[model samples]
Target: MYGTALPTRPALHAEWIKIRSLRGTVGALTAILVATAGIQALSAAAGTVEDGSLGEDPLFAAFFGINFGQIAAIAFGASAFAAEFHNGGLRVSLTSVPNRTRFYLSKMAVVAALALAVGLAAGLASFTAGQALGGASAPGWDTPGAGRAVVGSGLYLMVMALFAAGLTAVLRSGTLVLGLLIPLILIVSFVIGGLVGGPAQYLPDRAGQMVLRSVEHGALGPWTGLGVSALWALAALAAGWLAVRHRDA
Candidate 1:
């Protein structure tokens, strides 16, 4: 029987199934690999960075995917909640669970887990593939910050996805969240940093950008860059939690 009970097995199981079964979410992770690694290959072939540009730096250019993969990340975040709204499943879910908070929290957990797995895979694959292709890469393990950059690139993806998911929670509409987050992080953030001059360097996205490089060019170092990104994630997630508490499911 269709159980419409509050916080029942059906709701939790259904949500889990929904996250796994969602094509957009699954494919987003895969794109992380394709975007980062594929672009790295292209960049190497294109001669964007010189042979020793990233000398022992682990091929910083491989992170081209981080910029590209944001598109897929945006899609995953939007679909995480938007699909339900589009299909009127949100109504049914709310009715079944009765507690909006629990329903929303469950979705957040599932989405975060998905993002983490995809991010880690993308980060590791990008590094390995980039190095193999760009032989004598600048950021090889011999470099001082090579390892950190490699690890941080992967972590950065996870954080960005988390930030996007939280943004979706706040907006509660797929189109709105996607529209806002993409521009805010990609376009607006970049512009503001450019206009604000040297000081804009502290912005979350810019700060996090350091992780993509084998060397630290910004005010903050690799770990600090990640820390800046984490702050944004926390802030965004906090906003989302408030939305979950106040808004109807």
Candidate 2:
């Protein structure tokens, strides 16, 4: 066995199978789809104002899912990795590969890939459904640059998911990681935004929305906003890698 090498790609494939098999993933994705569709339907059916303008801005209107979507994305991303740890399954995973980094990366790769897929489908579906619901002749998927929002949203969600996975690794417990991260990502950002006024523009979650919005109005540009969020993910991932490398299973 020493002379033979481990199949890194296959390990990732195996992890992929393991994650989607869980009920939580199905529940999370279902919530995202329903929330997005329902928001679009409401906005669409809402009565329009005069002067040929929607009561809601189409750009922001199309992305109502961004708010709750993040929660579903995080739950889906962390569920697999966190579940294994919660159930003491990490020992089994690490034992199979014995390369700690590989194990973490394998899980990361699988989770990130699924996040990207789910993000794209959900974002696009929300945009399409919302626009159609609005009854104002929204842009089609093939329309130039019309597709970027879905792709960007997907990438953003994937990064955030990986970020969650990293947090789980560092904390080493599902409940603890969720406890610490939920308030920081979900709750506190809102409170800080209210108090800080202008500078709250730079918070990772706030800035990350730039990629999804129809308009960009802030100190941070579209790419810059995505970069800020990426920095958070990278920082968490680095910490996770370090933890996995140095700690015992």
Candidate 3:
């Protein structure tokens, strides 16, 4: 006894409802906040300026939990879209909306907006908790670049989640996207950035994370690094759109 078909409402509104209805969506968002804030708070307590462990930048240290939080972000994006591909979900969605382009764009927009909202909240919470735990090394709110770093944390998370969603759309499997991305971002990127140095900075997560750093260490500046990550997301979305348009539902 479902009422009207989903397409009768504004496409964006329909997409929002569909995503919000999923239980995983709420779980993922909660994980983003808890992981980012919790881990950073713990890290801030454990690390110190004297040992040079987390580096001297309090802002950088404060945002450190993002390294873990992004895993949740990626899961949110990948699972949200990928779930549609299973059990004839995409087929049912297409039947309602008909226009693949509109459906895809609307879906992506909702995922992006949702991620950005939660990401911002997570960033703010992480920063506040981190500062409180940072003892003497923590920077004040007015510290130069502090605000940018906090905002950047949200932007970075949003782009990373979108990146995962776009990639998931292409693959049509949440598991595949999670398997591929989590390791790439968490392990491979870390190892490569450590050993290879300069070139590794171009990797999507690394590039996006530059904005969270207090100082620019790589070829790409903070904003430029984030731009690189956005470019990666855009490319993945373009590929996903093409796949959804031409392939059987």
Best by the TM-score measure: 3
The prediction achieving the highest lDDT against the true structure is 3
| Range of the 10 consecutive residues with the lowest summed lDDT in candidate 2 | 47-56
**Tens digit per residue, CA lDDT, model 1, 1-249:** 223323445556778888778777667656766776677667666666566564433345656666776666666766776767666677887777666767766676676667667766777776666666666643456666667666777677767777777777677777887787678678876566434236556666667767776654657776787788889888888898788667655
Per-residue lDDT of model 2, residues 102-124, tens digit only: 67778888888777887777788
Which residue runs does candidate 3 get wrong by more than 4 Å? 1-9, 46-51, 193-197
The alpha-carbon deviation from the true structure for residue 191 of candidate 3, after best TM-score superposition, in angstroms, is: 1.4
lDDT of 2 at 243: 89
Q: How much does each candidate deviate from the true structure in C-alpha RMSD?
A: 4.6, 3.8, 4.2
lDDT of 3 at 178: 94
lDDT of each: 0.68, 0.70, 0.83
Arranged by lDDT with the best first, the candidates are 3, 2, 1
RMSD of 3: 4.2
lDDT score for residue 222 of model 3: 83
Which candidate model has the greater lDDT, 1 or 2?
A: 2
User: Which is the winner by lDDT between candidate 2 and candidate 3?
Assistant: 3
Error of 1 at 13 (Å): 4.4
Question: Per-residue lDDT for 20-53 in model 3, tens only?
Answer: 7889877887789899988987777776422356
Q: Give the TM-score of candidate 2.
A: 0.83
